[model samples]
Target: MKGIKFDGNHSYDAYQLFLNSYSIGEAEPNTNLVEIPGVDGAVDFTEYFGGVTYKSRILKMQFTFIADRFGLNAAYAKLQNALNGRRVKIVLDDDREYFYTGRVSVGALSPDGQIGEVTLTATCDPYKYKTKVRTATCYGHTVGKGVGTVDSPTVTLIHASVTNTGGAPAVPTFNGDKAFYVTATERHAGGSSDTFLNESESLPSGKDTAISGVEIPAGATQEFGFCCVGEGDLTVTIKLQERSL
Candidate 1:
């Protein structure tokens, strides 16, 4: 049967939670719908202004596994530790190459007979989920230099770091679509904040002067690139997060 693999440790497909290497079932993925209610008997519009809109979505899965008496208890014990309140990665289809991260809370363990079967119902909590991330590192980048080009793979969320490799200070700035800027002293590292893409209202600093909430769409490229001004060998590392959908 078709199944999904759970990865909490980034082991790829190695650590599927299925006890017998099989997935029993899954619930239909649901959309988190937001309904905007209209004022009753409003004079301006024909229909009520209230309509259902969609945004972040979530899914719940009920996976059952079977193991002999020898492996039953061990499997349940592993599930308890592996899934409880943990942000885990999931791969539903390898061909699709899509991944998702969410908090997994495993419900009660129901044992059928002594060790024949165990059913685990897990609820996935999600504000967002990510597919595989692509990372690139630029080393020994000099100041007052121009970076050639930068692009996003999807509606990507990116986190970047500029580490001072030399003895003196460096200030790095990336200007273009969804640009990022940082100012760091000697031997210090400054980068994008984790909340840079998550915080919609305000700009969060990455321990320096930077802008948060840069939304880069898929297949879009930034032509300007990032540059630095300072005394040290600057290493720039960038990580991009693509939405699972």
Candidate 2:
């Protein structure tokens, strides 16, 4: 009954394949070391280059494909077609709440009578992403909680509507850092059904649209609201995914 789901296709149901064994490779650190002329050990430049970087993780799975209604050759072909060179989301039966994204390489399939054993190696990203995407609604200066072992870099803003009550423009802030600016023309009046005008528009001049410096830290509650040059009220929804090593 133990199997893997690759790109939304169940291995057992699709190819009559069952997981026999598996192994996960640890994330290797990407370090820079300099060998000195007479030093006992190499000088580590990992900290100098903004801390340690992580290489891609590896997941190896051994599966036994039992020929049922379909012949062994047909089933093996199906499995090859599904995973050969495709980058997909891989979800193991043991960890249903997290998924790894990578390209699966199908190894040699050794056939014995009606069964064939195959090895699958997945070169995955360093982190596993949560299956569920969490949402946080912000009303003015609202705070939201983050749950994960690592910080998430992807944050999306949606259903954003702003009302500028003061004379100056309002800029959205996440953890006291500027996100984007809202001009007077983009503001919605009180009781207006129209959303903010700059929902999908690019940021103001010299501002990047990609949200940065606003990552949700692991197990921390951060404030995500607006700071006005005068006064403003903003209503928006934030969506993000939690990731871990």
Candidate 3:
């Protein structure tokens, strides 16, 4: 069953939309060129500095909508109401483990009685993100690897619990580089099961200022080390989404 899932809803299952054919565009790199006065050629910033930027990719699909009891017009209306002009999480049947975030444009519906044909064009982000988020938990020190073609800039500190065994406060670091402090009010009391991550509100004051997060390079193992200003026991968990071209 070859089909497309938009925003976690399957096209075929929800609307009886059958995918006839599909095509994916190439991951074209965007060029950075600077024109200089009296220079023969434009200065290529991307080529000289080895930095690459990508434009949005396109995914086109041809689909046939089969109407049941409601009719073709009803089916078309339902499909339009669900997808048109909306940003969606696109998951193809061929690759269920990865997803692309994009906006879908539905073409005009051409109908022959109960059946109709239409085209869908998705303008997606350059990278295909892994569905599963990778998590690494450590008591004091641990190693974790990022699995993708590009480095992930948004790493989240999902959980942290620190107890100062010594006289001073403790600070934990992600990848032994970026440091975030734990306040006395935010310390774990060892009785409650509350979590700080994924909360609706912003992080506590002072805790959000220090930790800027770390960049995890693709396919490289990075060490996460936690050190206390005095002596303390710390447990922290971090998560990241890996993406590739």
Candidate 4:
């Protein structure tokens, strides 16, 4: 686990002196599987009855630490700071990374006066822990000029938004094989879009505002294109991450 690393505003091994046992919580699906009322016993109706979503519950975790008065105090301080509500990333056994982004509450503290060791328990809010993250960038393109592309390296859910600080209306195209577009009616206002694709997607100047989802296969490069619809410049930002299968 030499490559194993972590940072919760600090290094993971920084607490090695006090660190005892660490374990990750189980992962649950972020979707609802509903059953159809009139289905026959031979067929599973629930599989076709409801909508599935991408939101996950908090990722529960536990860590045990053994330390003395000074070590205990230092460990407490580090965990205390993490409780301020920022996410803490942990690289589990050099496998993958997970974050404690919600709540991190400390359990009861136990002290061994004679041995000078303290035991502590910590809990994290539920979350479908995230894996590695990657980024892609797209430059602004004027309306009717050409399309812009944003690429990704894995099967990912692309979260993207574009801000037009300039004084003009614009339309962005999201294209892979099929095309999706977003339109802005006024100037200086910002608009954003999200899509998942394996190959590529483009944004063109148009008046349609409907958005859709796309699939980005693993190791595939996805692209996003844009064009000015009115009179100002556009700035596009895109984020990509692999989704739990």
Candidate 1 collision pairs: 143-228, 154-218, 166-233, 196-213
- Please write out the lDDT profile of model 2 over residues 43-158, one tens digit for every residue: 98986956356899999999998785347778878888889888999998899877899999988878887688889999999877762222233345422212321112232222
User: What ranges in model 4 sit over 4 Å off?
Assistant: 1-7, 11-17, 29-67, 70-78, 81-100, 113-141, 144-222, 229-235
Question: Which stretches of model 3 miss by more than 4 angstroms?
Answer: 35-40, 47-50, 68-70, 131-210, 226-235
Model 2: residues >4 Å from true position, as ranges?
Answer: 38-40, 136-210, 226-235
Tell me the deviation in Å of residue 32 in model 2: 1.2
> How close is every model to the real structure, measured as TM-score?
0.46, 0.65, 0.64, 0.44
Q: Give the residue spans of candidate 1 off by over 4 A.
A: 1-3, 9-58, 62-66, 93-96, 112-141, 145-210, 231-234
- What TM-score does candidate 3 reach? 0.64
Per-residue lDDT of candidate 3, residues 56-120 (tens digit) = 99999899986754488888889999998889999999988778899999899988666789998
lDDT of 4 by residue, 1-245 (tens): 13223353222365432344555554443544455678654443433554333333333333444455567667756655644344445444544544443334445445455223323332343432343322222233233222343332221222333442212222233332113323222223475443322223344322222244433443444444433323233443333333332
Tens digits of per-residue lDDT, candidate 1, 1-245, equal 45556673421233233433423233233434344468454243322443222233354555554555566677667767776777676656433354655666666666666443333443443222342222233344333211322222221222343332222222232332222323221221664322222122221223222234342444442221333332233333333344323
Sliding window of 10 residues with minimal summed lDDT for model 4 = 164-173
Q: What is the C-alpha lDDT of each candidate?
A: 0.39, 0.59, 0.59, 0.37
Q: By TM-score, who's the top model here?
A: 2
